[model samples]
Target: MSIDITLTVNGREINTEVSPETTLVQLLREHLLLTGTHVGCDTSQCGACTVHLDGRAVKSCTVLAVQADGSEVTTIEGIAVAGGLHPMQAAFHQCHGLQCGFCTAGMIMSAIDLVTREDDLDEATIRKGLAGNICRCTGYHNIVKAVQMAAGQMEGRGHE
Candidate 1:
């Protein structure tokens, strides 16, 4: 049986029917065609499917489509502002925080959540905050730098 769900994604309201077993990641990539939220692993061990649900970062793979109903979801595509890159996105680009570019979206999403929630961010704090998101490339050194850089730019902007 298919259930109808309504949720706001990437600042757009979406209404659709999905099987009860449909995951949020599948709904995004398959139904909504928001391919930026990658499904690296179905088991949620990999944070590649990370996105913001109600302003909090979550693994989209672990969340069911039905669970996201009535919630606001933000993908990497939504983070950009008016044809410009978000501070975190810009920092990632400037810091060379990605290679192969597979995990960059999730990493940036998670980093945005990290910067918005934390205060007085330091290297260790940033590392701990991003522990859930994994990056096989760039060794996380540059990733940390990107977060640090974006933290400054994002300050007082209240990016969410």
Candidate 2:
């Protein structure tokens, strides 16, 4: 049976009919045509399918589409606003945080949420905050730097 549900995605409202078993990752990538969320592992150990559900970072692969009814979702595509890259995205690029780039989308998303609403940000905090995300390339050094830089930038902007 197809289940109908409404989800606010990337600031756009979307209503979709999906199977009860349809995963949020599939819903975003297949149904909505938002392919930025990648599925690296089916076991949910890999954080390649991370996204924001109702402003909280979650692994979309572990969530069902039906579970997102009436919820707000933020994918990587939504982060860039007005043709400008988000601070996290820019930081990642500036810090050379990615190589294969397969895990970049999820890593960036997780980092953004980790730094959001945070007052204290340091290398340890950023590293621990990214504990959920696993990256094979760049060895997490640049990724951590990117998160720290993004955190500083976000903190500075919080005052403006």
Candidate 3:
């Protein structure tokens, strides 16, 4: 059976039909064609498929498409502004937070959430918050630095 669902992705309304077993990642990637939200591990052990659902980070692979009905979803594609990248994304580029870039999307999504939830972000705190997202190529040192950089900028700019 197929179910009709609506989603707000990248600030645009999307309407589609999906099977009950279809995951959120499948809906975004296959149906909507937002491939930036990578699928590294289908088991959700790796946070590569992370996306923001209702302004919080979630594993898209673990969430069913039907479950996201009427929700606002933000993939990496949605993170940029009209002419510039989000502060968090810029920080990642400046800090070299990614190597292979496979996990960069998920890491940025998770980092944005971390900055939103925490008032005081430190190395240890960033590391703890990012424990769920794994980077196989680059050590987390650069990732932590990127999060810290973005955290400082996010204080005045606010979280996305």
TM-score, model 1 to reference:
0.95
| Model 2 vs. true fold: TM | 0.94
Quality of model 1 by C-alpha lDDT: 0.91
Q: Write the per-residue lDDT of candidate 2 for residues 24-135, one digit (tens) a residue.
A: 9999999889999999985788798999999889999999999999999999999985878999999999999998999999999899888884567778888888888888
Per-model TM-score versus the true fold: 0.95, 0.94, 0.95
**Which model is ahead, 2 or 3, in terms of lDDT?**
3
In candidate 3, what are the lDDT values of residues 74-143, reduced to their tens digit? 9999988689999999999999988999999999999999998888777898899998899988568999
lDDT (tens digit, per residue) of candidate 1 on 1-160: 9999999998899999999999999999998889998888678887999999999999999999999999999999898989799999999999999987888899999999989988778999999999888876646999999999999999563443
Error of 1 at 71 (Å): 0.4
Q: Candidate 1: where are CA atoms >4 Å away?
A: 157-160
Q: Is candidate 1 or candidate 2 better by TM-score?
A: 1
